[model samples]
Target: ARNAGIERATSEWIAFLDSDDYYWPEGLSTLRLVATLTGASIVCGMLSDADPGRLVPEELQVSIADQFLAVMAFRGVVPPLSMSSSAIRRDVVDTVGTFSRSHGTAEDREFWIRAAARFPVGIAFRPVAHYRIDHGHGKNDAHFASGAKLYVLRRIFREVIQNPVVEARLRSDPASDVFYRLHQSHLLCLDAAIRIRAGEMISAASTLSDAAVLCHTADELYCLIRELAYFLTFPRSDPYAATLRCSRWLVTLARETARSGDRRLTDALLVRASDAIYYTARQLRRSCGEQLAWRTVIAGLRVVPTIRSAKSFLRFLAESPRHTGHSLMYPRNQRG
Candidate 1:
């Protein structure tokens, strides 16, 4: 849809704003002054998210192609100005190419990456637009929360960052390995996130195992774990709520990591995750009745096969009612 709009544009500059979003009164004029002064093919203005008081421009910051590309590639954090607040020179669009239909939710990020690789990008720290976030859909661009962005991450990994020339350029940098690992970890964690959301535990486990065993070294694997930790956001909401959110994923990740030949890391993670889930299950039993909590207990037991879990299993067997499996044959009021 954006590409189609670009095709029909006949101006020297193209600024994109969605129907639901709007530009500040000084937005276009601010970008125009900066574009004319800096000669940047792409000019990005800050939105309300950058800083509430950062609406006035002090200076137009020019981002070097290599530095910009490296930041996006390695840091796994995108503080770049967004499309809603950016204006690109009409001619640059042809070379940077159209917004990719294949990148799913990351087309904008992917486009800026490609643009930074070739053309100069200018940043104005003034608020240029009031962009609305659709919280209900789980699309937060600031931190890359959308699992759909995995499409473009895969492409950049395969096509841009791993290209021989690109790799050679970063090889001389002292922090190259750190940068590379962080970016690599984002790919690993995001892929895991998508699979887990889709209920494809086997696939997610296999991917994590491959990363731990085949794809990464010790340092790199640690980066992967750290990135995964940030994504999970457990322990904060933790003993019960946090456990309910992140412990299951940790348990799954630990199981797979252990299978990939690292038993040492498994114990601590498994214990924490399983303990929380186990306690939550027992609590559920008090309020929701036995049958519902039984399922939670079963999940906890799957995570950690400890003596406590065994005891809980036996206790439930002796105290809980059995499932005859024929109660549905009769009406609900008449069934046992």
Candidate 2:
């Protein structure tokens, strides 16, 4: 649907909005200012679950350069920006190609990977749109219930991971080790998660053991938990529901990974799994409503009362990074 709209748009600068999401006027202005100042083919602002003047009050990092893929693959969890909060020049769009119909739920992430590789992506610290999450459940085998989300993820890896262009760009980057570590960790976790979902305990356990070895720090494991939650993508009504599911998956896999391995690694996975829940719950202070927001918080922290604080949580608001996401540099001379 978005691709069709892109085909029909007559404007040189194209922006998108979903039915449930709306752009903030100030946010659009910020994006335009960033694009104009930087001549970036793509510019993105933050997204708020509620309509807000800004997502956060603190001064946030605003990036301008061809490091979108670096940030994305390094972060290894979510996209650096939401497409709803982003605008692209027509020429860049034509060059990068439209969103993939094949990805279904993750087309935006796929598009960002391709576009960001070709152009520098500009980031402006502002809330660009009110992002209403999908919380509705599937009834009687509808709405991504029948293993469709997994299939979409598999397809995404097949296309983006196999594409030589993005892979080469990432490999050539100076920060290639961290990018590969994070990226590889996520891929391993994805395979393990799929195994856990399929009741393949032995396979899931073996994969988790390898994933633990690949993850060098608690921070990496923190991102891994978040990645699993984001990848789960179902029952989105509660932000932490995915984390809870991730925790369960980890515990189940841990039970199996424990059978044979360093007991310390097994213990580490259990600890990180619990910690991830607390961290996510603490971070999601949605402006939607106090009651609902706390529900997400309480749901997470209630399980394991140990909460660890980190400034990195603010990135969720400032970056609006979704599932692994991109760079485009638009030149002023090319525009009419």
Candidate 3:
């Protein structure tokens, strides 16, 4: 395959393209600019799913250390096979070797992993390619497989251990490692609950037990306990009733926290409480046969002055991130 391509190629640079893919106008120009400025051997660009689309922009690291850390922190997760989105120097390929055909499902991801480790990689932040997201004929499952998340976590653990740059950073900020592990564990728990909701109780319990191992702090434990309570009562109770009860609990908690006179805490709690109510309203809107806009929710909120510490919480909640992405199971897990 390499010989065939090399014989026909006349260009100084080479880029990849799969049968069904194509590039945007600005993509190659962005890659060319980066290569010219940095003398980079490889350039990675952004890719969008052929259907719904990507959640984040194409990310790059200023240094190998930063790259290593980000990849490790997020676990050894790789993007989909859309290597054609990137452009590479022909000389770089000559030195590093051609792509491997061995990977059955994730060939492109494997290629980039090797490339980034071997050479200076420039990034073009512009979205370039359209990727075909196979839906498996409407039996589409977006959640990670049984052990896939854990598998990636373990791989990231190994990579960081091997990379001196990442190891030093972890040693310098030991809490960061704890924080990552805590998040990984929390996701595992959330996945378990979602599986249970999808009718996989045995798997849920097994996964939750594994997640319990990652719990390190009382706050972490508290979050899991609350989630457990919610899940346990979820099936038996009406969804609206559950949402209302949870909203009331959150509101009471925020009110009590506000009474303590800690301005930041008061605002934070209020924002969280209001956001919870807002989300519940969204879920209930369809079930209750009513549609709501953000403006409506805000208009209906009790009057609270933005100038006051507690009042800011309500305002913050009103402007909180919404329709941004899927909400993780335990909102508290978002913070350290």
Candidate 4:
């Protein structure tokens, strides 16, 4: 239906807006001005979640040298350039083709990936669109469920990773290696989350290990560790099993980071893994009052850097007595 509309439209430039989202009064004008000035095939404007309550800023055009990297950084979780917030030169669409129904709910994402890969993408840093957060159960909500989200992510990964054009582009540039790793890591994390939610503990652990290998930055490693903690701590099935799997993966990841000579990341992973073990043990004690010896937990704690250990000790002391009871009750298992 959207493709048909695009085909029939007479305009040289195209913009889209769904029924649930709206553009600010000046959105079209701002986009047109940006496209005119930058000559970019695609122009994206700043998107806001709520009303600006003030006049939109003057259009500030910025060139995106690496469209894939720029879009990945800008969009984060959401699709890059929501339909309501971007305008595209018609010829680019004609050349790259329109949205594909086969990609399912990730059509916008796939389209943006193709467009960005093929042409320059410009940003207009003025709030030109407001993407309303719908509370109702809509089509989008259904697509956000575990099965649907996983399917979309897998499709996106296959499309981006398997595309010969993207592969060639990355191989041509030495600086693109990090970005490629970052992209792969991001997809692996998403896949791992879905697997964890489905109670595929071992598979999740393996996927996370792959993600950890690609993580060069502390921030990336920390984010991945936090996701692991969240899913393992709040497992849908067996929390103990989830925690055990996560603890093992984190210990392995810590060793890898240490080998990479990233002390901060290594320490952070150790701290996170220890916390997972500590919480899991506490949960076990509370639920079954059964003491389980874990060599992995001790190994993680034994390797914690001195500075990180001091911080962990201070944090533990600040917690309530009930929170610290589990650690104190159990004989600390010693291993490295």
Among the numbered candidates, top lDDT falls to 4
lDDT of 4 at 172: 74
- lDDT rank order: 4, 2, 1, 3
Off by over 4 Å in 2: 51-61, 67-73, 76-79, 134-144, 167-185, 215-221, 240-242, 254-276, 279-288, 292-302, 305-336
CA lDDT of each prediction against the hidden true structure: 0.59, 0.62, 0.47, 0.63
Per-residue accuracy of model 1 over 279-332 as CA lDDT, tens digit each: 555545543445555666665576557775677656654554444544322224
Candidates ranked, most accurate by TM-score first: 2, 4, 1, 3
In TM-score terms, candidate 1 sits at 0.51
Per TM-score, the best of the predicted structures is 2
Q: Write the per-residue lDDT of candidate 3 for residues 193-286, one digit (tens) a residue.
A: 4665565655665666566557655455445534433432221124344444434443443354345443443444344445444554453343
Clashing pairs in 1: none
TM-score of 3: 0.40
> Candidate 3: where are CA atoms >4 Å away?
1-10, 49-81, 91-96, 132-201, 208-336
Quote each prediction's TM-score.
0.51, 0.73, 0.40, 0.62
**lDDT measured at residue 135 in model 1 versus the true structure, 0 to 100:** 19
Which candidate do you rate higher for TM-score, 1 or 2?
2
What clash pairs does model 3 have?
none
Q: Name model 4 segments beyond 4 Å from true.
A: 54-64, 72-80, 135-137, 164-168, 200-206, 219-336
How much is 75 displaced in model 2, in angstroms? 1.9
Lowest summed lDDT across 10 adjacent residues in model 4 is found at 70-79
